[model samples]
Target: MIENRNEFLSKIAKQLGRPQPTSRPERNFSFSPQHQVLANATQEELVDALVEQCKNIHTKAITTTTADLVATLKQVVTDYKATSVITSTDQRFADFGVLPLITEHWPQQEVATHQWQERCGQDNITFAERADVGIMVSEMTLAESGTAVLFSDKDKGRSISFLPQNSIILIPKSTIVPRMTQAATTISAMIERGEQVASCVNFITGPSNSADIEMILVVGVHGPIKMAYIIIEDQ
Candidate 1:
């Protein structure tokens, strides 16, 4: 086990033929570009920014209250005309009243839905690839870029969002932040606290588009052709 940072710094210092400094330097910047971007914005402003950014990226964004979450979800499911759907085992689905919609309500509406299970193995990827829409809850959202931050694990298969033809992400209003800077700070804090960060942290902004050839654009080349975000006013 390592006792302290001295050994680590000493090795680097020795390589450079210098002694390791005993103290660290202080940051005395007059301003931080990261925080300055949306420093004075309120939650409402951030939400508005997120919605507008979604439109700019060709993603459908809807805002609704918790009471209407189920209805809004149903509408999105129907609008997407999803015959079969797959979702991660993320408990936010149930916590946000989405599990019953997929499990109980979807069947009533003749829509088949499956939740990812480790025991299912490759079955999860197969279903997700064939499914019409994939659904996930954003752990954090970047308003400036209209991006959804997802932490994928065993129960939360990354394919749930990648393989589907279309994607619909649920975003709680309270999770909305200024931009990626805030998102980075969140992950950094988690690391400093010795929390186990997932191996996969997906930052998705709109649908997949490729402009590789002749600078021309082709949507859905790598991922979903269509994407939507249902923002819940949970806070």
Candidate 2:
């Protein structure tokens, strides 16, 4: 794709009866309405927006202090009545003091916990498919849409978010942005820095809800049946 990008654009330019531009044209407008929405929102306001938006997407979202993160997560686990669980190997699980849920708490409750294993191959998919709940950290949270931005890597399998019956995402308060505009800008900056972004970046908006069949809303058709967000005040 990279090698043929210029050629692809040249064909489009020819159809439009214009030469291919040497570079992107300058923006004529000085301000963008999208960039203005919630542009000056405080962290608390952003959290509020996320919670409100989550309601519309059929997701439950709650805010908690870092001190109460583990307890809050445990409550969510119970709310979902999770039996078998799978979690991504996110460092935040350790940093936020929630790793015990995967390491000890669930085990004490006689629940099976499976962490994504890159070397184990299909074992990850098999476990994720059977797991009652999938837990992972949201790299970026979009307040406007109550979306969790997840970047998949070797230690984090994408199946954990899709193949499970329920999804419980841990979000850091500081990671909340106004909307996708800010999220895209952050990713563009990473590209500018020559940083390698994950090839599969998922912008998941709550649970999977489809309205394709006669415009009837059907949940869990494409992903988890239920999705919840526990926002941690790590800022």
Candidate 3:
């Protein structure tokens, strides 16, 4: 196999009238003009752009103040008539008083949270799959693509965001960046600082959709059918 592979490569090189380089090529690591523009965007501009872009992709973006977040979430639960809900175990969500609001507004609803110490195993999966709403706190959000970054670990399970029919992401306005590059830089900095990054970083732009069959667009084929982002401006 080695001989055959070398011969094939030699033949290709001969056809091109040149020898194949044996060293890694130099890469130009410069930002594009579009990226530069996004990089320089102000926070208010990023928030506005994110909301508009999110809507373009069929995702709902709702801005709320820290004091009004509980009220906003209540409205969301009532609107969806959600009877089963799952929430990430991130302390920020708890600090934002999401758990108490859930209990107060939907006392009869089934609730399961991603546990930091113990993997609930099949029980967690069942709850997530059957959940009418899944609430997650994003690590960061990108304005250019209207994407939310979810770093999955023991405390924030991947299924908590993907398995539910509907997803509600609680994004702190402070974490909103102008583009993917900025978000990537933050993750890289974390790694450089010896932080334990999650095994999987999911970049969700919108609810799962595809235009594969007959070029007809369909939503929620593989993930949530409905998605809503609640951006907490005060947080």
Candidate 4:
């Protein structure tokens, strides 16, 4: 019985002409589009144009000094009557000065952990929900688009970002990449260096939400109602 079955399968294979598979061709599947329009732009002109375009995205941006970032954050919390702020444990944020503010509310809390999700969600969801603003340090910035790139890692958990009602990102001007091509190049370099990119790499343009309901506009449906970016001078 086994021999007959094997013979039958061999005959079918011989009749079917089973061919060996070959490797796929290397094609350019990159995000960069080789268009003439982008090729003609100077770095300064590109950054300026990108910044202007981003401003019109309905998001707020402020040119900030390191000093201003701390002061503004303090002021916003005070104005909103917010005593607590949820932030990542990333070393960069140490200099941004978010710890003291957070400590005021959760006195014993020195670091933000994922476990806060449940408590934060149950407590009106506004504390850190659509009203809870999370301030984070970005991995890089696209100068041509004035966009911030966020990568999820141990220090900066993914939940801290999406869970908040508003997200305030702090990026330095010097880390800005000129174009999408340059951004992709940086990504490729990271991959080559054996560094595993975060599970989620969010490219935040502005606040979330869609106006497709009746063609009217609405914000903060799926994400934060507001997104504020602090572009600090590259020093």
**lDDT values of the candidates?**
0.91, 0.92, 0.83, 0.64
Highest-scoring model, TM-score: 2
Q: How many Å off is the CA of 176 in candidate 3?
A: 0.6
lDDT of 2 by residue, 1-235 (tens): 2798999999999999999999988888877899999999999999999999998999989889989988898888898898999999888899998888789989999889999978879999999999999998999999998999999999899999999999999999999999999999999999999999999999999899889889999999978999989998887
lDDT of 3 by residue, 30-86 (tens): 846656857667788889999999977789999999888989988986688787788
Pick the winner on TM-score between candidates 3 and 4: 3
> Which is the leading candidate under lDDT?
2
Clashing pairs in 2: none
Root-mean-square deviation of every model: 7.8, 6.4, 4.3, 9.7
Error of 4 at 38 (Å): 6.4
lDDT of 2 at 44: 94
Work out candidate 2's RMSD over C-alphas: 6.4
Question: Where is model 2 more than 4 Å wrong at Cα?
Answer: 1-27
- What TM-score would you give candidate 1 relative to the actual structure? 0.86
- Prediction 1 global C-alpha lDDT: 0.91
Q: Point out the worst 10-residue segment of candidate 4 by lDDT.
A: 109-118
User: Candidate 4 clashing pairs?
Assistant: 129-165, 130-165
